[model samples]
Each structure stands twice: as C-alpha cells, then as structure tokens.
Target chain A: MENASVPSVDNIRFDGSARTRWRLGFDRVIGWLLPLLFLVAILPILSLVYYVSARALPTLSWTVLTSTSPYRTDALGVPIIGTFEVMLLATLLAVLFGLFGGIATAEFLSDRVAGWVRMSANLLVGTPSIIIGYFGYFTFVLYFGWGLSYIAGVFTLSFFMTPYVFRTADLAFTSVPRHIREAALGSGAKPSQYILKVGTPIAFPQILTGVFLAMAIGVGETAPIVLTTQPGVLVPQTVYSPVTFLTQLIWENFAQSQSSGLQVLAFQAAFLIMVVVIALNIVVRLISSRYRKRLEGLYA
Target chain B: MRWLRWVAALPALAPAAILIGILVALVGATSFTNFGWGFFGFHWDPPTDQWGIMVFLIGSFLTAVPALVFSMLIGIGIAVASATYLPGYLTRILDPFVDLLAGIPSVVYGIWAFVIVAPVFGSVLEPWLVMHVAFIPGFGPPTRTDGLGVLISIFILTLMALPITTLLIRDALRSVPRDLWESGLALGATRWEVVRRVAIPYGRRGIFSAAFLGFGRAFGETVAVAMVLGAATNLPKNVYDTGNTVAAQMFELLDSAIGGTGSPQILAALAEMALVLLGISLVVNVLGRRLIASLYTEQVQGL
Candidate 1:
C-alpha cells in the first residue's frame, strides 16, 4: 500500500479552499451583475426605440406615405423620397470613388502614401459634421453659387461618406490572398482585368457594406443638407433646385410646434428614418460577418 | 497602364484635396483679423463687432468633459462585463444591440433627446437634482422646458459616446494574451482580480487611447448637441442653464452668413471657428496617437 503508484481516491479529491470559495463568490456576484450592467448600458437605445415606436408607429399610414406635403399638413412622401434620392446618389458616388481610391491606395501606392491616405481619412471622419456642413456651404453654396442644389448636397455627402467606403475597400483589397493575385498575374492577365474580374469581385461584399453604411450616414445628415439644400415645399425640379429630407422634416416639425399632432408627425418621421438607418446597419453587419466567416473557412 | 494607377488614385485623393482647400480658404478668410485676444472673448454678436468665442469654448468643454467622464466609467464597466464577466451567450445577444446603438444616426439621437429625454429631465430629473444637490455647480433652478441645457447635452453625448468607448475598451481587454488569464486563475486570482490587476494594466494604453477618442467624439459632435443645447451664447450658470457650443453656434453663423447679413468680418469669424474646431480635433487625435506611441512602438490595433 505504501509503495502503490496510484493515489487513493480521498487523497486526490478536491478541497474547498478559502481562496477558491472567495473566487467562486466573486464570480457569482459578477455573473449576477453583468446582465444588470448591460441593461443600464443599453438604456438609451431601449428608451429611444420605446419612445419612438409607441408614439410614432400609430401615426404612420398609407395616406401619410403616399401624399406630398405641399400644404405642409403632415405628409412625408416627398421628404422620404428625397431622403432616398440623396442617400442613393451620395452612396453611389462614394462607392465609385471608394473602389478606385481603395484599389489605388491598397494596390498601387507605396506604404507611406497609403498610410497618409488612411490618416487623412481618419482625420476627415473625426471632423465635425457641422464643419463639413460649413465647408460645403463655403464651396458649393457661396463660392460656386450652386445655390441650394441637390448636386451640391450629393457632393458634400459623398465627400463625407467616401472615407468609410475607401477604408473598407482598402481593407478588403489588402486582405485578398497573395496567391490569387500572383496566380492571376502569372497567367498573364492584364492588371486592369485582374482588378476588375478578380480583386473587385472578391472584395465586393465588404465594399457594398461600406456603401450601405454611407447611405445610412447620408440619410441621417441634417447639417450639411440644411446648409447646402434650401428648404422647399415642392419636390426638387432640377439638380440645381432646393430639397427637403426626412431628418430636416423631423427637425423643422419639432421646432415649429409643441402640438400633439405635430409631435406625432415628427416622431413618425424620426421612426421612418430610424428604420431605414437601422436596416442599412443590419445589412452591413450581416455582410461583414458573412465575409469574415467565409475568410475563416477558407483559411481553416 | 501605369497612368491608370495614378488616375485611380484621384478619387481617394479628392477628399483630402478638398479638406486642404477648406483649410486654405479658412486661413485666407481669417488672415484679415488681428488674431487678437478679443477673438476669444465672451461675446459673439457680429453686428455689434463683439465676436468673442469664450462662452462657446467653455460650453464645449463643459458639455464634453462630464460626458467623457460618465461614458468612460460606464463604458469600462460594459466592456469588462461583456468581455470578461458575462457568459458567451449573453455577449452574443448584447453585442448587436450595442452596434445598433452605434448605428443610430446623430439626428435620431437629437430627436430622442429633444422630444423624449428633455421633457423627462424637465418634469422629473431636474426638480430632483435641484432639490437634492443644488449646491453643486452643475445643479440649479429648473427652466420650464429644461430640455435645452448642458445637462441634457451631456446625457445625449454620453449615450452617443458609449458604444464606441465600450467597443474600443472591449477590443483592448480582448487583446491581452490568454496565457495571462490562465496564469491568474492558476494562482488563485478571482476573475475580477485578473481583469483589474492584469488585463486593465496590460491594456491601459488602448483604454487611454479609447478615452481620448471618445472625448474627441463628444467634443466635435454636432446636430445632436446643437438640438439639445439651447445654444444661448452665455456662460452656463448651472448645467440646467442653456449654454452655447461652437458646433451649435456654427449653425446660427451659417444662417446669418447665408442671409447676407454677414460682413467679411463675420464670415472670417465663422471661418475662425471652423479652424478652431479643426485644431481641437487635430490636437485630440494627435494626443491619442501620442498616448499609444508612448506606451509602445507597435501599431495600435484599431482606430
């Protein structure tokens, strides 16, 4: 028994040490607290969702969704359409620029130049939205005399959003497998062909996600649009004409009256805008996650 | 074919070019000013030639500092709880909500603050604060609406800043090597102790950088802050008092400027404000980069 190689069961049994007990107690308390903390942290979102939905959901209807607010009586159709128009146009421009710039930054530029590009993008992203608004006013409205035009608004928004798209496209391009590029080049494919056929297709999902995010950003913007696009009741007759947007509707409505009817309409406008923005964000998340998973699968 | 690469680069370069052009124009606009101390004075009435920016400056700091402090404390807690203390399944559910919060537009947050939070503060929160802690500099007599004030701005800014701060800190905490956690557990350290003594210390650089970034975000945020803040151009007597901010005042400036009521001086003053905003953000970013640089020479993982 004394010379046995194997330990006895009792000797090998776990001990409830004081340190272990304290650690367990700590873990238990933390486990209980974690959910509570999360709830507190998420209070703003929950509150916004709750308040916006409860007040606004009832007000949204086919009537409100179909008619223009030429009389300013609470219809949201024109503003909603305008929002989509600006968002789509801005995102399209941003994505096109992003694709070209991202490819150039990632594939053609030197590392130092690429770093500069990234730094500038970060700086632009950090600049206040209002500052961008001011800049847009200074250039398009004042200097160029574009005078409250859709083209001006679109350009301002595209400038604001292109950085995100550029960064995403750059990242996507950078992440493309070296072998694929080498193989394409080795097979004597033209650089342009390789980029258009191989590089862009591989990175399309990420690039698209950036475009969606940019659209969300564009849809939500008030300051730039307010600065560049003069407010009008009618739909814009030309690219040079004034425009109105959903966010501006919300802003103008709330400021105009404390009346319950106006408040409801304002809330409704907010609600609709939120739905679109959140939907775009969800698409971004889904695409990025799917892309990540596919990458992981390929590597694994 | 080589020219094609440079041509492709132009799109990316355009934004940067535009940014530089804005700076150059701003500098040119402001070149006429004496660059005197009066420019930073309290008054901002352009017609009277009283075009100081001190009130807005103070208001900006007042709104941002508290929000930064609040977000940091709450954000650190959230990061710790979600990344280290909480179960994986819980994180899977909560993380998306946080991201959604981040994705909510600044305009929407403004609307929420204006319509929902402002009234709640006016009716419930402000009265309680005045009753309990009126002695504090930030607490004072409540206005009728109580929505357009520094406190409301702080509240909204804190909420707006939370997701970014939390995500950054979470990334920081997660960057710590697994072996450290294993070692801490092996040596009879509690999970909290491991996070407190090891994980936080190890990731302090990232956390500090995150703090600076979050502060920068609050500092430069527009629309939301402008909406909630009443944009009165005065030094705030208390948090409840309506205070002006640079971003908020920029809107007014633009309006007047666009109305053609503004002189070249007024336009230059607006330009100067823009430059100030650009300078502050630049400094904050540089400070953030320097913080990360001083800690380690390795590339900081995320922006």
Candidate 2:
C-alpha cells in the first residue's frame, strides 16, 4: 500500500554497505503480504462462481432453459436465442464496419487525425454503458422512431463494441509491414484486392481478437441493448419488436423481488451469463495468446 | 487502392458523427434548462422539476475516489509483487484471474452486490458504522430502509476496478529494468528496498495514471453502483446513506422519459445530467491519457 516509500539519502548511505537484518525481515514479510493481496484480489471470482452455482444449481435444469419461470414457460429459450441473435448481428456489424474503421485509422487518416480518432474511440470505450444506451434511446428510439426494437439493439451494441474492435484492428493493420503493402501494390492488384488479400490476411488474427473481445463485451451487456430492445418474454419476430436477453433477465430479477420461481430463474440466468461470458473471455484469451505467440515467432 | 482507404475512413468517421449527434442532442436538451446553472446545484428535487445534480456528482465522487484508493492499495501490491517480490511462476498463475476479472460484465458485479453483499452491509455494517463511526461525516444509517448505501457501492466498485488497475500498474512496474533491482540489492539493500527504491519510483507515473483510469471506470460504472446506491431520491447526509449517481439517474429517468408518463422537462433534465457525466468522463480519461503519454517527448529529443 505504501508504494512510494522513498529511501532517504541518509538511509541509503548507511545501508549502502550493510546487510541489515531487519531489512531482510521486512523483505520476508512483504513477500508474504503481496501474494496475500493477490489472493484477496482473486477471491471474488472464486466466491462469485461458487455462490451463483450453489444457489441456482437445484433450480437450474434443462427444463429451466426451456421456460423462464413458473408462469412464463419456454423460459430460457427466448433470451438464449435473442442474445445470440442480437450479438451475432451486432458483432457482424461491428466487425465488418470496424474493419473499415480500422483501415481509416491505420491507412487513411493523417497521423494527427488518426490519433485524435483513436483517442475519441478510447473515450467512448470508457463512456458508461448506460450513457451509450441512453444515447441509443434518444437517437434511435426517439429520434429515428425505431421504438424499442431488434435493429436498435444491434446498432447500440455494435457501436458500443466498435471502438474496441476498430482499435485493435487498426493497430494490427498499421503494424503490417510497409514493404508488404508496397509489394502488394506493385503486383498490379487493385487497391481493394490488395487490402482484402494482403492486409486482411496478415492482420486477421488481431482483427479476430478484436471481434471476439467485442463479442465478449456484447454478450454480458445489458444497458444499451435493453434500452434499445426492451425486454420481452418472447423472441422478436420483427426487427421492431422487444426481445429478451440473459443480462436483462438477471437485472430485472435482482432489481426487485419476484416469485421464488422467478428468484430461482434469476440465479439460473446469472449462472448462465457468467458461463457464456467467461467462455467468451477464455476464447479471447486463447486467440490473444496465439497472437502473442505469433508475434514472438516473428521477432524470434 | 487510394479510394479503398477512403472507404475504410468512412466507417472510422462514423464515431465522429455519433459524438456530434450526442453533443447536439445534449446541447439542445440542456439549452432549455429551467434552473440555468443551478441545475448543477446540490439540491436534487427531480419531482419538483429541479434537476440539481450536485448530490449525484458527490455520490459518484465518493464511490469512485475511495474505490480508486482501495484498488491502488491492492494494485501497487500486485504490481510490485510481480516486478520484484513474487516468483514469475506464482504471478503467472494470477494472470488469467486478472484477465478474466477485466472481462467480467458490470451486471455480474451488480447482482452479487445486490443479492449477497447489500444485505450484509445493510444489516451488519451500516448500523455498526452509524454507531461507532458516527463521528465521521458520511457515516450514518442508510437513508433508505433497504440497507444499500454509498459504503457498499465503494466496496463493490473497489472490487470491480481492482483487475484493470492492477493490470495497468503491473504493466508499468514490469517495465522497470531488472538491472536496477539487482543493483540495489548489490548495494546491500534488501529486496524490499530494491522494490521501494527502484521499481515503484520508476513506474510511478504509470501507476498514477492507472489509478486515475480506474477512477474513471468507477465513475462511469452504472449498474453495480446503482444496485447498491440504495435511495435514488435522497440527498445522502452520511456515508452509509442512500444516494444516486449521474449514470444511475440517467438509467432511472429512461423509462419515465420514454413511456410518455413523465414530462419532457424530465428528459431535458436527464440530458443535462448526461452532459455533465460525459464531460467529467472525457476530462478524467483525457487527463489520464496525457499523464500516461508523458509531456517530455520534445524535451527528450533535444527540442
């Protein structure tokens, strides 16, 4: 905790040639203390997983996924389908558009403009999810007359995720060797072909990493999607209809008291979200690790 | 080929439009504010059409700043531990935990805080703090009966911000040259001295910026803090009192503003709050980035 314990000149001068016993003792204590802090930092993940599982396991059956609660049958299917549908559509929008955004940042803009754009995107990344959701609500729901609907949700989540996606992809493209870009251009290929065949293939892993990262964020995201696509018990049959999502289910259940069946349903939903989110995160971890290894190989 | 880059630029330019759209909407909404600059005043009576956001801003400050301090305490430990104290293998095991923690959604934290942590804080800690620490200005009973309070929000925010701050600080500490550490020890300084005298100072700028970014994260955090903030209506008088944040108020205002139940004034007021929150987030994050980027580049190149 006391990170800035600057050793004064006097202490350093005296300890310069002396192997002080207490100094070693203090070192031993810190060696124990730090890892303990690490443990404390790691404790929440362990307890959260344990707590949700223990609470929801009994009520969490295959049938639970088929129905939302005691009254709402076909319970989990709606959200599962809705979540995947929204995320797939959103991630697709973000990744495809994000690739174009990456090109702009990496290849198109002047250095100053690119830096500003990247920084703005970074600012947007940290902008509260709720704010983005409200923005979606104001712009699309109110301004565009989209209502609380599927396409609104997709756009909201994609915009929310786009900054991260484009950022990584942008960095990846910028790092693509200049020589390779020139070689592709010199080969008499059209610019589109050169970019698609040459730049895309090289930065594919990092781009994929960004896509997965965005998906991981999109999966557990509730606010923006919820604001745009207000939760319903059923999957939307139209682009302009309310649809359910796992995070919304959890948020609603915990926000207010519900029936015990609904309570159990909340935990089930939480447990499932945790699983999918962590799974997505692990996939990201795998992809990033592979990307790291590849980079290391290039350097090696 | 030249035009292809422009094609990519089109989508990249999209965010600018989004930002402008948001700004225009907020600017238009806020231009018609009923109370002028008094909208940011301390008293928050939304029902009375007084959308003073001083309390929500205070609520955000109280939760995030303390969480930053708490996360820094843990973060400095982990960063220094990995850099100079802990063995590589041990820190390696903790890496995935931090990574996964960084990826966790806010709602997961929100639910846990709501379901499990809030009750304990409400029943146990709130009364104890009110009784024993009543001398402290913020330490009072929960303003709402449900037991959620600023203290629980701080606790949860600390937990939520831990991983990112730790990772950020860890990156900085890891950048410290190993030679400096060994040289310190060669001078008969203990490992503790090597860390205290060498690694930390070297990465202090990064560590500071990291902590600042963590504060930004906590400030912008909506769901988790809202879940534990207790009473959205009350202007909290004590640490354990119920409160609201700008982001939380924004969320709460959404339904009423959209459902045609609330007047346009409410939406307008909420827009002002969003503008305030957005401004704060930008300043904090931009300042933090500037700190991390360092202003010494020109000087370094002998400019």
Candidate 3:
C-alpha cells in the first residue's frame, strides 16, 4: 500500500493561526446564527402576505373585482377601472418615451450625451415615486390647474416609469452585437433603417422585459397616484373625466369611518392589486427564463 | 459622420433635459426670494406663517441613520455567508425570497409593520429588554404603543433596503476573482481568513455603494413611513418616541397645502420638498458616479 503524503502538523507554521482560528470560530457562530437571522428578516414579510390575504381573500370575488363600488356606498367599480385606466395610459406613455430615450442614448448620442442620459436615468430610477407624485401635484394639479384628472396621474406615472424602460431598452440595444450592426450597415441599411429594422427587432424581447418591468412597477404604485389621481369612488363617464381606480377605491374605503359596502369592498381591491403584482412578477420570471433558455439552446 | 452622431445624440438629450429641468425648477424654487434663508431659521409656526425645516430634517436623519446602520450590518453578514458558505440549493431558495421581498410594495410593508411587527415588539422585545437591560438612562419607561416609533420605522425600512443591499454585496463578492481564493487556499489559509482579508477588501467599494443605495431608499421612503410611523411632528426624545420623517411630513402637509391654507405654508412645504430632492439627488449622484468610476477602474486594472 502507498503511503499518503499529508503534511505533518509540526511542519506547518502557526503564524496568524490564532487569528485564523478566532475568525473561523466567529464565522462558525455566525453560520449557526444565520438561519435564525434569515427567519427574523422573513417574518414580517411572510406575516404581511399571510395577514393581508387572510383578511382580503374571503371578501374578494369576481363580482367585487368586476363590478364598481355599490352606489353612494363608497363601493368598488370606479376605483378598479381607474387603476387599469391609469396603468394602461401610463404604460403607453412609458413605452413611447422609453423607446425614444433609449434609442437616443444608445444609438444617436455622443459618449458625453450618453453619459448624461445614463446619469439622469439613474437619478430618476433612484428618486422616490412620492416625489414624482408631489411634482405632478404641484405642476399639473395646482400650477397648471389640471384638477385631479387622469391626465395628471398618467403623466406623473409615465415620467417616473420611463427611466426604467429607458434603462431596459438601452441595455437591450447595447446587448445587440456590434457585428450585427455593422452587417446591417454593410447590407446597405441606413442608420434609421438599421435601428428600426435590425436593432429594435433583435432587442425586442429585452425591450419588452423593460416595459413589463415598468408596467409591473407602475401598476402596484400607490404613492404617485395618492397625490395626483383622485382617491375614492369617482367613475369617469369618459377618459377625459376623473375616475377612481381599484387602488383609490380601496384606500378611500379603508380611510372612511363608516362601514359601508364600498368601504368593506376595499379589502378586495387591495387583494387584487397584490395578486396582480405577484402574477406580473411570475410573468417577468417566465419571460427572462425563457429568453435565457432560448439563448442556451442556440449555443448548445 | 458628425451630423449622424449628433442625430443619435438628440434622443439621449431628452432625458438629460428633463432631469435638468426638474433640477432647475427645484433649485429655482428653493432660491426664490433671496434663496429663502428663512427656511434655515428656527420659526416653525404654521398658523402664524413662520416656517422652519429643522424638525423634519432631524426627523429624516434620525430615522434614516439607524435604519441604514441596522440594515448594513445584517445585509453584509447575509451576503458574506451566501457568497462564501451557503450551499447551492440554499442560495437558489434565498434568491427567490429576496426577489419576493424586493417586489412587494412599500405600502404593504407599512401595513404589515403596523399590524404584525408592532405588537410583537411591544409584547415581546420591549418587555424582555425592560426586564433584563432597560435600566439604562435612554431605555426608561417602555410604553405599549412605542412599537410604532422611530425604532419600528427603522426596522421596517431595514427590511425594505435589505434585498438591494444583499444583491449588491453578493454580486460584489462574486466579482472577486477565483485566483485570490486559490492563492489563499494554497497558502493554507482558512475560508474565513480569506474572506476577511482578501474578499472584503476587494469588495469594499461595491459594498459601500450598496449601502449608499440602501441609505437613499430608506431616506426617500414616504408611504411606508407615513402609514406606520405615528406621524407626530416632534423631535423624538428616545428611539421609541413617535416622530415623522421629512418625506412623511411632506406627504401629510401636501394635501393641506393643496386645500389652500396660506401662501407661506405651501411655499414652505414646496421648499422642503425641493431641499430633500436636491439633497438626495446630490448624494446619489456622487455615490453612483464613484461606484461607476470604481467599477471601470477595476475592469481596466483587471484587463
């Protein structure tokens, strides 16, 4: 049998060994404590979802979700519609602004201009939604006298969400290989044609990912809406008219003292928003994973 | 070629112009009427048309600092453990959980804090602390509803910031080259030593940037703070005393301003918002620039 060549303990130097042992002990202690720490970190989140769902689920139904709040009762329909209307409008605005901004930053601009665009995008991303809400409240609602209209809310959310889309689109465009762009140009494509036909199509999935992310963020957003969009049950007769969405309906219902049917109905709106956010997150995951799988499949 | 480049650049200019406009408006508003030195002076009577932002400033700092510290400690520890010690399956499990936490709205977290965490802290941690170690001067007189104070706000804010901090630090740790680890291992160093001596040093700037991002998130957070924090517009005597942050106070006051109280109060609130927007923008920009520069430098050095 061959003898193993393991180093002898005596031959090993113990310089800084004590410090190492202390560190090892500290790490071991931390390792043991980590699961408990993670549990503590998770407790509030788990309990939140559990408690909100428990309070909201039994009350939530297709009727509550589909129908407006009961009349004079501070009920549901107007608010749900309001939420969707605002989100849809905001999403559209975000896509348009994002596409232009992303294209400009990635393809059209000099490096200095691109750098400035990137910085602004970062600042916008970092800026709180409430601040945007306040800006909307000040500029549109008060200064310009828009008066709590859908235009105010849509503009506010769009401004805030556009940065996200811009980041996504820019990344998407950048991810397209230089070789492809060159090849497109070599094939007699104009710059505009190259961007519109080649660049955008190649980056469509990523651009969609960005838009979806913005939408997901915009849909769940309560702060910006809290300031600009009128809260409570106000059903718009038309897109130009002011209307409360599901979130507003819920907030108003919860804010009131009297336990009217509409007030009771808010629990359902809250649940629906939560469900929508979770579902959107799932969709985001699915899209991303699918994109990754496609890439992997091609390579393999 | 230059004209084409300019054409391309035009699109990028739009966002920059928008951001610059916002900054200009904010600064212009703040600087209107001789730069509004009255904003800095101590005269906070709303009814009498006296305005001071001292309380809100104190409130913001008080809430944000503790939250930043607590979250950084816990987040760094978790990131380190996940990066170095955690098994693959556990890491994957934790990733989704982090994402879930990140995805949940701040308002929902506020509701959760109000409903669940408050009672637990009031019933459990407060009593235990009082019994065992609350004899200290700052720790006197534990109250029941004190759970909804600055401390609880900090706790909730910490949760909000944790996912970002964790993700950033984890990425930072992952960016540390394998050669460093291999060298350490060859030298017969333990994993803990290598992490403490090598990995953390390399990841320090990244970790700092992560913490700064957390600070920004905690500082600017309004809805959650508004919902759960008792919203008493006072300088908190103790960590357990009810208080309001700058953002929360702005939210509470914005509606009133809209309702047409007076010109001074509305202007004062506007000035406050402008100040906060400027402060946060400056800090975030500086930190972000530093982070990007550091990253670029690292990449260059690596190449």
Which of the numbered candidates is closest to the native, going by highest lDDT?
Answer: 1
lDDT of 2 by residue, B108-221 (tens): 888777777777777777777777877766664444455677888888888878876887777677667666765786676777777787878888887877877788889988
On the 0 to 100 scale, the lDDT of residue B152 in model 3 is 84
What is the per-residue lDDT of model 3 for residues B1-303, given as tens digits with 9 covering 90 to 100? 768767655656556665665665455444354426666555556666556667777887788888888888877777766666666667667656666677777666665576567888777776776677667754666555537787788888888888767667766777777778657756766566677899889878778887787788888888778766777756777667788877887776765565566375466456566566557755874695468433222111100
Q: For model 1, what is the alpha-carbon lDDT of residue B228?
A: 85
Candidate 1: segments with Cα more than 4 A from true spot: A1-27, B29-31, B140-145, B289-303
Q: What interface RMSD does candidate 2 have?
A: 6.4
Q: After superposing candidate 3, which stretches have Cα over 4 Å from the reference?
A: A1-26, A69-74, A246-266, B1-9, B27-38, B41-43, B142-146, B260-264, B293-303
Show the lowest summed lDDT stretch of 10 residues, model 2 chain B. B294-303
> Compared with the true structure, what per-residue lDDT tens digits does model 1 show for residues B37-106?
9889988777687889999988889999999999888888888877666656667788777767777878
DockQ of each: 0.36, 0.43, 0.32
User: Under CAPRI classification, how is model 2 graded?
Assistant: acceptable
Error of 2 at B55 (Å): 1.4
Candidate 3 chain B weakest ten by summed lDDT: B294-303
lDDT of 1 by residue, A1-300 (tens): 011111111222236888666666766686567557677557778899889999888768998987986885778878877877788788888887776787878888788877777677667766778878878877887788898788888888887887777777787788789999999989998878888899988888877876787777778878888778866777778999777788877766755667888788878888898898888888887887788798778865
Instruction: Give the TM-score (vs. native) of candidate 3.
Output: 0.89
Best by DockQ: 2
